[model samples]
Target: MKTSIATVCLSGTLEEKLKASAAAGFDGVEIFEPDFVASSLSPELVASTARDLGLTLDLYQPFRDFEGVGQEKLRQNLRRAAAKFDLMNRLGISTILLCSNVGTAVSADDALAVDQLGRLGDLAESYGVRVAYEALAWGRYVNDYEHAAAIVRAVDHPAIGHCLDSFHILSRGWDPAAIETIPADKIFFVQMADAPGLTMDLLSWSRHHRVFPGEGGFDLADFMGHLLRAGYDGPMSLEIFNDTFRRTDPFRTAVDAMRSLEWLQELACQALERDGREGSRMELSPLPTMVAPVGFNFVEIRADDHRLDQVRTTLHQLGFTDAGNHHSKPVELWSQGGARVIINRGDSTAGSPAVAALGFDVLDPELAAERAGRLLAPPVPRDRGAGDEQLLGVRAPDSSEIFFGRVGRGGVPAWVSEFGGSTEVTTDPLVTRVDHVNLAQSWEYFDAAVLFCTSVLALDPQPSLDVAAPTGLVRSQVMSTADGIVRLVLNLSPTGSADTAQHVAFASTDAIGAARRARERGLAFLPIGENYYEDLDSRFDLKPEFLEEIRELQLMYDRDERGEFLHFYTESLGSVFFEIVERRGGYRGYGATNAPVRLAAQHSRRPIVAAP
Candidate 1:
């Protein structure tokens, strides 16, 4: 695929945007009109810069409100089109995007629109430019892409064709299969964007909420399939208008956008393969097969060299056994049953304990890592001595390392031998394995993290909701595999507070017994208020004895038609904590409804200095 991104999708001067796009491996760019007009560079200079950066000026946009007008208005619009065409000539761009008239169109007559578009096409032809007429979702009359295509056909001018925008088409709930009916040659340009499901005015959503493909709700791969099945082979461009992207570093945003396109291309390729399109006209490079992890191999925690004793104490109290240090590194393993936690005292200067990396057991580790690499995840290089166990890793958007490991015998990683090898030393273990991991994301990169989980990790995202916190509302999304293993909860902190610590929730066979044992071992339980238990009784009217036991244990509870859930949290130890959870019957969720209460409890016990 010939990938491109509009200059509007990033934050920078025009030259900076071009360079960022090129550096991110874009073949071309659509120069959004406002960005060009605001730039200090002339059209020739901008074109020259794009050429120097090894990029093609794909398209110039957007000449708006050019059709369905009276003769006088038509003359003025043609004059405007002439000016833009001249500009495109100077920029060495052959295509100009003319949006279907959104305003100032005096008529809705199809004949008038066709006639005026023909006149504009003549003007474009004079400047050796092609007009890609696009339908705005909120256009006055010609709002549907099929309607715009019909107009283009009636105009029958070689200079005029249809521009298929995924946002405009998908946002309006138009059937994309209709794209296959339009002749491929008539489809002059394609701009792809995705957006979250939003309830707002069309213009407002289109202007501000558009995200790169795979980051939103649209089925862009399906859209791409339909376009490809129609034989349309051209630059697949991105034109996102997001507030975050507009304000962030252009290079970073460009890389994120490029990653989205890479994922989208892979999805489209798979879609075509599913349809048995073996002889595709476009030669798309095939990506490695996606393989989801079967289970977590290990969760690594990093802290100052002398600061890990507190975290280690909590783990020990919670029934984890010391599994000894790595044979070659400053790392110690703690385990409860099959759940392994690696305490890495690698940087003594590191501030507090945090989840530094996660290793998962996949059927094929190298294959999974290769897929992640193709999806634009930066490969994480691990420093190792000879004869060390090699774990392939990639960096997530939040800067956490994700490693893929080969499935070991009896759920134990083969690399455990690199350490002293003792783990959980228990017949009837308290914590069985990692039930889920909670990662805190910065507000700006929350959506990007969601895409990373879905695309790079191959996890499916559950419906997202906002959990009330003492500071502000925190958006939480749970991503997991279909079989209820490998759950990851992503919490977007409203204020980006480091105090919003990352946690690992361990599944217990008996939550009550485990809580009692940990309490006996002196685990500092994050205290729950009496009113919460009072309200809980009102909500579920539990047996008095069970309720009393839970209150004594400081456990939180949630029940659904499927099953009941019981869980308890450990007090924050620097920037890391733990949760022990039990599911009775067939409970599938992470007890999300109690998140606000948990957040409140954690807030009530704050005050962590930067010092470890």
Candidate 2:
């Protein structure tokens, strides 16, 4: 099923939000109330723009304090509701979010609240709109998903339904199993937000601490499993209210959000598979005819320098053996166990080694390409043979090629069986797969790339961010495929100069350990100030040693109630730098808190010549 995110997830104005949503692999977006209120674009115009960008307005939210209120307040709210409904109709939005009363009327009894909700539901029905009633965790009363669902059922109106928010449900320590009991039809919407678990006031925490999925500690896989089991097929909108996210580059933020969602998708897929759910199995098209004997096959890196040789040497020292060379490609293979790293000495002049291409082996390359093409654009063929093409290819946004070919049957290299060696084994574990790739692009090409990934590659768009410099410089646009395997970040340079892509981040299972290992290897990293962590006790109940170590190492951090993330940046190499991240428990986002620091470092290091 197609997935959608709230447009508010993108840190920008309404127009920018729509563009970012389209780019981020989102099938649709929930239009937040604030964006609509602040937008100069008419509802019709906004709807038209959404259509032009190939986005659906999945929801129009939120009508707050709609249930349990005084006569005068009720009248005022009804009028506002009517106006919003009209606007939604103009904007071609079918779903409306009605948040349960928070402050004033939350004390009202459930009966009164249900009666009020029924009236609003009847009104919504009049306008041909469905009302998604959401329970606020901090509400005066009725602050749980089951409770909200009960109210909706009590209201007994087709137009009234419950909106399940992952944050509210999990943060309140509610049982996720309750999801199974609710009728699937009663679920009008599903809102998701990941957070690092912390001992702080929920109000302050929810407003400032939300992160993207996979970056937090919540068991979102289990939550999604429950929903899937209940047959919920609705848009899972991300509603994060992060301080750093709002301040960072919108495009990059959106890309990060999409990546987080992609990770969640993978987790969900795994969970569903474990549960033996029908239609949950992920069968790679063109099953492998010859498997590489259940061992590490290869690890690929697209780099410029002999530095890649150093990386290879490091891998060798760690226990990998040289495999073989690609006939025409600039790639060499190294392997140990079931893992392999393919080092590509392809144009690393672009600064960091971005993933230039991915080569996968399948049973039928042609059929794999065909299935992929049906989902995305047809693969761009790169190699032709005497009788037929040897492999099938697809071109990604950065002009990199993704190739699929047969590997084992007559495809295995003679060197595969001859290589044997036991290299040094360190206690430190290397990163788990190339978690994701980040690409840099000019502003103008951003949307086109997003469209290519979404329409041609069949990848979903994730959430995004809008970043502006203190000098009022704004660069934006980010997109990623669903499943978080690929990410593309676009920047509209303030000076509008064309330059090669810079900076690439690799994921690590243990950020602190990686940093320590790198430090021991004599690599210098930027330091995080002590003042940031001085208030750790007040903000989070973390252990003193852990907090002190993080502060001393200059790690940046942010968390919600479910998980925490720690990240540190390395010295800039030209325009690029590296970020090492470690997620503890439910964390799922890159540390946005570190963006300003990284950008500041970049700005400081940039050569300063007198203006001509």
Best by TM-score: 1
For 1-612, candidate 2 gives per-residue lDDT tens digits of 465777666677889888877776677888888888899999999999999989889988877876788777888888989998888889999999887788668345788888888888888899999998888888777788888878888899999988888998898889897887888888888888888677898878788877777545678878877777777777667888877667656665666565555555655665676774542322212211222111112334666775665556544433345666655556576754334456677665744545455555445566656644543433685544233336567765456676655555444523333333344333445554333334566543344355444433444455555454434343444445444444445555554442323444545677776666666665657555455667555777788888878877767777866688777766644444456666677765555555555565556555668999
- Residue 109's lDDT within candidate 1 is 90
Per-residue lDDT of 210-295 in model 1, one digit per residue for the tens? 99887888888788888889888899999999998988889878888988988887878987977756335676876777777789
- The segments of candidate 2 whose C-alpha lies over 4 angstroms from its true place after superposition are 23-25, 209-212, 242-612
Question: Each candidate: what lDDT?
Answer: 0.89, 0.65
> Can you tell me which runs of candidate 1 are displaced by over 4 Å?
276-280, 421-424, 496-499, 608-612
For candidate 2, give the lDDT of residue 224.
Answer: 78
lDDT at 555 for candidate 2? 73
